[model samples]
Target chain A: MKFGVLRFPGSCDDVDALLAARRVGDAELLWHGERDLKGADAIVVPGGFSYGDYLRAGSIARFSPVMESVIAFAGDGGLVLGICNGFQVLCEAKLLPGALLPNSNLRFTFRQVELEVVQEQTAFTCACGLDGPSPVVLSIPAKHSWGRYYADEQTLADMEGRGQVLLRYAPGHNFNGSSNDIAGVSNERGNVFGLMPHPEHAVDELTGSKDGLCIFASMCLAVEAARV
Target chain B: MKARVLIRPKAGILDPQGEAVQRALPALGFEGVANVHVGRMVELTVEDASQIEPMCQKLLANPLVEDYEIVLDT
Candidate 1:
């Protein structure tokens, strides 16, 4: 599988994502201005302060020229993963439901966080062993000022009914005051996934945790599963 | 035409910045402060007045968690 990691101006984690992708499969760096995805089977929108987080995080990056192709790629059923600011961008682009609000503490939170795999049936979490004995917990780093997931009651209800909520902060560890402790969510089709934590940052053993590799591995499995 | 847009978090959506400011006001000796909701103001030069709403809907504000008001400057 080929992974395209998007690089936008002010994006801080593009390199990290590229390295993470390289560890799993062939990876390429995609520019924000390019209208093509370079035939990537899956795309990863890496974490960063895209557009310097001006006018709200991910708001400006959503309008980048490459996003047009990203939208089309997703519409064609290609897998897409958005991490940190990428999650904000996906929400702004309307590829995913709900919005990420400022943290309730009004401070930038940067630390390793525990995430519970709420739904592992999706392409992004299938490697977490959904049918296992207990919930799969990942030690991933979440670094952001606006990471609180929010949505209206009806929309939240629909998301819950559809199994769209993919991950939540483990019980009693909700750091950002996200509603329902939502740490990540998937699009209705489950092909698109967005999460606040930086999975790429946690993929290396040198980073003290390799738990995030499962997320990328899950994408590889999804791609192989689709080919069957 | 010039338009001024005010975008704010919707009611019931948490506004941590505003809450922080509200808490600081009393400590700073300001009294009678009930609540504070911080919002953003955007100024735009547009060709048509009618385009303002669409701009708000498309980019200026996310209707899911924010509400935007547009005022045209004559």
Candidate 2:
């Protein structure tokens, strides 16, 4: 599978995302201003201080020309993943269900977190063999001031009813004060995924953990399964 | 018309910068700072008055996190 990682002006994780995607298969870095989607099978919007976090995290970067293409790509049933600041961009673009607000403490948090895979059938986590209702713990890094996840009560209920809660903060930790401990979620169709944590940072064993590989591998397997 | 757009943090959301400013005000010889919520204002030069809503929706502010209004000059 070929992955295209977007690099907006202030994107800091573009290289790490590119390297992670390459580990799973072929990948390329696509500039934010480029209107071309480049025939990529899957797209990953990596984390960083896009547009210097001006106005709000991800708000400025969402207007980049590449995001228009990413929106269309996600709408067309292509697999799209947004991580950290990328998650904020997705929310700002209205591609995801909820918005990311400032942490209740209003401080930037940078730490390793344990997240539970609440849903495994989505394109991003299906390869983990997490077939049961139980949650699987995955270690990842989160770094953001506005990482709190929020949605209206009705929308939150709808997401829970549809099993759209892809990941949640493990017990005893509510990093960044996300609503209902939600750490990640996918679109209604389950194709577009967004999370505040950095999975690409955990993809290699040498980097301390290889658990994040499941998400990258799952996307590849999911696309291949669809083609079969 | 001269209008000011008020951008304040939505309710239930924390405003650390505002909090820090409020804390520093007493030391700066300012008294009676009841609630110090900081915000920004952008002065716009518009050729058409009908462009307000779209400009606010598209670029001026994020409706999810902020609220804005316009006042016409008397």
Candidate 3:
């Protein structure tokens, strides 16, 4: 599988995503201005202070040229993952529902966090074998001021009914005051996934945890499964 | 024309910054602060009045989380 990681101006984690993608599949850095997806099987929008977080995080980056292709790719059921600032971009782009708000503490939060797999059947979490008995907990890093997720009550209920909530801060550890403790969510079609934590940053032993590799591995498995 | 745009988090949404300020006010000897909410303002020189709403909808405010008003400076 080939992965295209988008690089918008001021994007900080694109390289980390590229490194993570390289470990799982063929990875390429895709510039924001590029109109095409470069034949990539999956697209990853990495984190960063895109557009210097002006006019709200991910708001300006949503209008980048490459996003047009990303939107089209998602519309075609292609796998798309947006991490951290990328999550904001996805919400701003309307590919994902809800909006990211400032942390309830009124401060930037950065640390290792445990995320519970709420919806394991999706392409992004299948590697955890969620259908098996035990719950899957990922040790990943969450970093950002605007990581609290918010949606209207009805939308939240609908997402719950449809199994769109993909990840949440582990019980009693909801650090950012996210509504429903939502750390990640996928679109109704399950083709697009967005998360506040940095999975790419945890894909290696040197980072003290390889828990994040399962997410990338899950995508690889999904791609292979689709090929059959 | 000069246009001023005010963007605020929706009423029902949590405003941590505003809450922080409200909490700090009592310590600073201010009393009877019923409620506090924070918002941002942007002043722009626009060529046309028609562009203001689109600007608010597209960039200045996220309709999902914010409400924005555009006022022209006469």
Q: Pick by DockQ: which candidate is best?
A: 3
Q: What is the TM-score of chain A alone in each candidate?
A: 0.97, 0.96, 0.97
Residue B5 miss distance in model 3 (angstroms): 0.6
Q: Model 3 chain A, poorest ten-residue lDDT window?
A: A127-136
What's the lDDT for all of these models?
A: 0.90, 0.85, 0.91
**What are the candidates' C-alpha RMSDs?**
1.5, 2.5, 1.4
**DockQ per candidate, 2 decimals:** 0.84, 0.42, 0.93
The docking category that best describes candidate 2 is acceptable
Which candidate ranks first by lDDT, i.e. highest? 3
Q: Highest TM-score among the candidates is held by which one?
A: 3
TM-score of 2: 0.90
Residue range B1-74, candidate 1, lDDT tens digits: 88899998888888888888888999999999976989999998989889889888988888888989998899
Clashing pairs in 3: none
lDDT of 3 by residue, B1-74 (tens): 99899988899898888888999999999999966889999999988989999888888899999988889999
Q: What is the lDDT of residue A227 in candidate 1?
A: 93
Q: Candidate 1 residues A4-102, lDDT tens each?
A: 999999999999999888888999999999998998999999999999999889999999999999999999999999999999999999999999998
Better of 1 and 2 by TM-score: 1
When summed lDDT is taken over every stretch of 10 residues in candidate 2 chain A, the lowest stretch is A127-136
lDDT of 2 at A65: 97
